[model samples]
Target: MLQLHPEQIAQRLDQLTELSVELGRGAAAGMLHGGDITPLLERIVLVAKDMTGADGGTLYRPSADGRSLEFHISINDSLGLRQGASAGVAIGVPGVALWQDDGAPNLGSVAAYAAHRRVSVNIDDVYQSGDFNFSGMRAFDGHYGYRSTSFLTVPMSDHEGELIGVLQLINAQDRETGLVKAFSATDQRFIEALAAQAAVALTNQLLLRQLEQLLESLVNLINIGIDEKSPYTGRHCQFVPELTMMLADAVHATTHGPMADFQLSENERKQLWLAGLLHDCGKITTPVHVVDKATKLETIYDRIHLVDTRFEVLLRDAEIAALKAQLASPAQADEITLALREQQALLREERDFLRHANIGGEGMSPADQERVRHIAQRRWTGPDGAERDFLDANELENLTIRFGTLTDAERKIINNHISVSIRMLEALPWPKHLQKVPEYAGGHHERMDGKGYPRGLTREQMSVPARLMAIADIFEALTACDRPYKKGKSLSESLRILGHFSLNGHIDPDLFDVFIRSKVYLAFAHKHMQPDQVDAVDEAAIPGYVP
Candidate 1:
C-alpha cells in the first residue's frame, strides 16, 4: 500500500472540487444557449468520468415513481454500453447503491448495508464482503468480468430538495500504486457536487421542452380552425407552406439577373416557409358565406331571384285575365286574353334567359349580349298594382355578365384581408427571422402589373419570394376541386390562363416558363391536387409558351 501526507490528500481533494465547479459553470453557460438535455447530459458524463479517473460511469434519473432511477447517460472506457443490458435500480449490482440509505458504504460491506438500509450503497471490494448478502452481487461481478475494487455514488436532488436520481462511478485508479482501489472520500465529495449541477441543468431542459410542445399544439389548433371554416378549402392553409418551400428551393437552384442577388440562407428559407403557412391566418376574420358564394344572387337582397318571382306573378295575372275574358262571352275578350297570355310567356322566357346569362363566365357571345338588354328593359306589375322595375340601368349592366358573386364593395372587403393579415402579423412580436412574414404573406394576391389591391405594388416593388407565392395562390385556386362556385379547370386550361397572365404582365413570364419546363407544377399537383383531378397541360393550347 502507498502512503501519502495529509496535506497532499487535501490538495488532491481541492483540485477535484475545482474541476467539478468548472464543469458546472460550463454546463450553466450551455444551458443559457437554449438548453438541450441530451447534449448536456453527455457533456456532464464525459467531464465527470475524466476527472474521477474511473473505468466507466453512468448517470441515472429518477423514474416517475421516484423509487427507481433509470440510466440517463452511460460512458464506458471508450464508448457507451447498450441501454437495457443493465436496468432496474433494484435488480443488478447497481441496485445495491439505490437500496441503501445511510452513510456511504465501502465495496467490502455494501451488500449487507444495502439489504439492511434499502437505499444507495457503494462497494470497494467484492471478494472481501463475506457478510454481505445480496443474491445478485455474484452474478453481476461474473457477467461483467469484474477485476477492479472501487466505487463512488451520490444522490441527485433538485433545488427543492426532492431526490431526482443518482450518479455512480466504478473502478477508480490509485495515483501512486498504479492499482485499482476503493473510491476515496474526496471522490465521493466531488461526485456529490457534480450531481447537484446536473439536477439544475436537467430541470431547465425539461421546462424548455414543455414550452416547445405547447407552441406546436397551438399552431395545429389554428390549422384545424381554418379547415373547419370552409368545406371547400380543406388543408389549403397547410399546403401553402409546403408549396412555398418547394418554390423557394427552385429559385435557389436557378439564379437569374435579379434573383441571383436574392439568395436565402437555410434559416431564412425556413422563415419564408412559416410565413406562407400563416399568411391566410387573417382569413379567420372573413365570412365563410362570402368565400363560398355559388351564384350572383347570393346577398340578402338577391335581386335576380326577385326578378324571377315577379315573372311568376305576371304569369298568374295573365291566367286570371284569360278566365275573366272567357266569362265575358264577347269575341273581343278572346283576343285580349290571348294577347295577355303571349306577353306573360315572353316575360317568363326573358327572365330565364337573363338568369342563365349572369352565370356565363365564357365571355358573352353576341346573342347573349342582346338578350341581356331585352331582359333589362322588360317590366311587370306587383300584387298591389304598383309598377315594379326588374332591373335599373346600372343593375342591368352589372347583371349582364357576372364575373363573380360578390359586389364590388364585397370584393374589396375580401381583398382588403391582405392588409388585415399584415396588421395581425405585425402586432405579434415574432422572432427576427420571421419578421418578413407580414410582407411575404400579405403580398400573395399582388400582381406584377400595378393592378393588385391593398398596395398595387408592381414587379420591382415585390420580392421574388412574394411573386412565387402569388403564382402558387392563383394556380391552387384555379385547379381546386372543392370550391362551390365552379368545377376545377383542367390543367391545360389553367396553364393557358396562367400563360395569358404572364403575357399580360400579371405574373413573371420567365419563372412561369421555368416552372412548366421543370415540371415543378406536376410535383405540387401530385401532392396537393386530387388524384383524378390532375392532368398534364397541352403545350399547343399555351400558344408560344415553351417550357
Candidate 2:
C-alpha cells in the first residue's frame, strides 16, 4: 500500500477537481464539435488515463452487429504506442469478443467483462487477483519486462442506460517513487465519472453523424425527384456537384493567384456540395413536355405530322386538277402532262423542306423563316370541313423561332423556373453556414453584368462558390449530351464559348481565368465529356484568357 501525507492528499484533491472540470468542459464542447467524433473519443480515453495517472489505456465501441467490442482508441505511455484514425498511427490490434460462441459473457477479459456487466471493475494488483483473468496482461508485461497491475475498467453507458463501450486504465503509478501502485478509491470514483462524460460525448458525436447522413439522404431525394422529372437533367444534378468540388479543391490548393487566398473550410465545402446537388430542385415543378423538347414542332405530339397531312391534301387537289385537264383536252395531253409533272415536283420539294425544318437547329436564318411563313399561307381543308391556312399560328411561331425550338410563350414558361427555384429555396429556415446555399445555387444563372434573372446580382455581389458554379453550369451545359437542345459541343468549342462569356461579362472573369489557368476545364472534360468532344484546346485562341 502507498500511504499519502495530508499535504499530498490535498494536492491530489486539487488535481482531481481540475480533472473533473476538464472532463465536464470537454463533454460540453463535444456537443458542438461532434464532427470530431473519432478524435474526441480518443481524447476522452487519454484524459481518463491522465486523471488516474495510469500508464496505459484503451477505449472500445460496440461493433456494427453488437457482437464485439472493437478498438476505437489505444494508447500505452510506457510503450509509446498510439493507434487509431484519430491519432493517425494505426497498429494491428484485434477486437475483444464480449460474448463467447455459446452466448456466455467473456469474463476472462477485464475490458470485455466490464462492458458485458455494465459496471466498473477496479483491481489493486492483477498478479495478486484471482476473481478475474489477466493472463494477456501478464504476457504483455512479460514481453516488455514490466509488472502490469492496478487495473480500472468502467463501462461507458449512454444516457439510455445501454452500454455502448468500455474504458480500461492500467498501471497507476506512485507519485514520489515512480513505481506501480494500487488504484485508490478516489481514482475509481473519478474515473467512473469521467467514463460517464465520455459516454455523453460519444453519443452526441454518433447522433450528429447520423443526422448529417439523414440530411444528405434528403437532399439526394430532392435531386432524385428532379432527375425523374427531367431525364435530360439527371446528369446535371450529379455532375455539377462533382465539378464544383473539383474547382473548389483547386481554389483551396492554389497559393499563388488572385484566388489563392480563397479557401473553403470543410463546412463550406459541404454547404457548396448540398447547394450543387439541389441547384435545380425546382425543376421538379416544370412541365416535362417543355423540358424534354426534342424538336421544333414538338408539344404533346409533333405538329409536323399535321403539316404532313396538309401537304397530302394539296397533292390530292393537284392530282385531281391534272386529271381534269388531261380528260378535257386529250389532243394536248403531252402539254398537260408536262405541267402536271412540274406541279407534283414543286409540292414534293416543299413538303420535304418542311420535314427537314422541323428538327431544331442552333440558328434559323431570316430567309428560311420567311419561307416558312409563305408555306403557312398555302390553303388546306381541315377535318371540320373548313378550309384554313396550312399552318396554325402556334405552328408557325415554333418553326420560325430563329434558334432552337421554343417560342416566346414557351421560353417564358421555361425562364420562370428560376423564379420558382429561388422561391422554393428561400422558404427554408437555414443554418448559418448553409444560409448561403440558396444564394449559391440560385446565382448560377446570373450574369456578372447584372442582367441575370430573379435577382440581377452583379459580379461583386456573388460568392466565389456561386461564381464557380456558373462556370460549371455553362461548361456542363455545353458538353452534356443528355439535353434536348443540341449535340454536346467539343471541349475546345466549349472553352472558346466560356472565354467569350468572360470577356462579355456574362460570367465571372476571375473564375473563368482560374478555370482556364488551373486546367479545371480539362479535368472536367476528361471525366465528363464524350471521347470525341474532348478535343485539344488552343489556349491562345481562347479570347479573354492569358498565357
The candidate scoring highest on TM-score is 2
Where model 2 places Cα greater than 4 Å from the true spot, the runs are: 1-36, 85-89, 255-257, 328-336
Which one is best on lDDT?
Answer: 2
- Tell me the whole-model lDDT of each prediction, alpha carbons only: 0.65, 0.81
lDDT of 2 at 395: 87
lDDT per residue for candidate 2 within 337-429, as digits (tens), equals: 898889888878988888877887878889988999998898877789899988889888888888888878888888787788788888987
- Model 1 scores a TM of 0.74
Worst 10 contiguous positions by lDDT, candidate 2: 27-36
lDDT of 2 at 269: 80
Candidate 2 lands at a TM-score of 0.90
lDDT of candidate model 1 versus the reference: 0.65
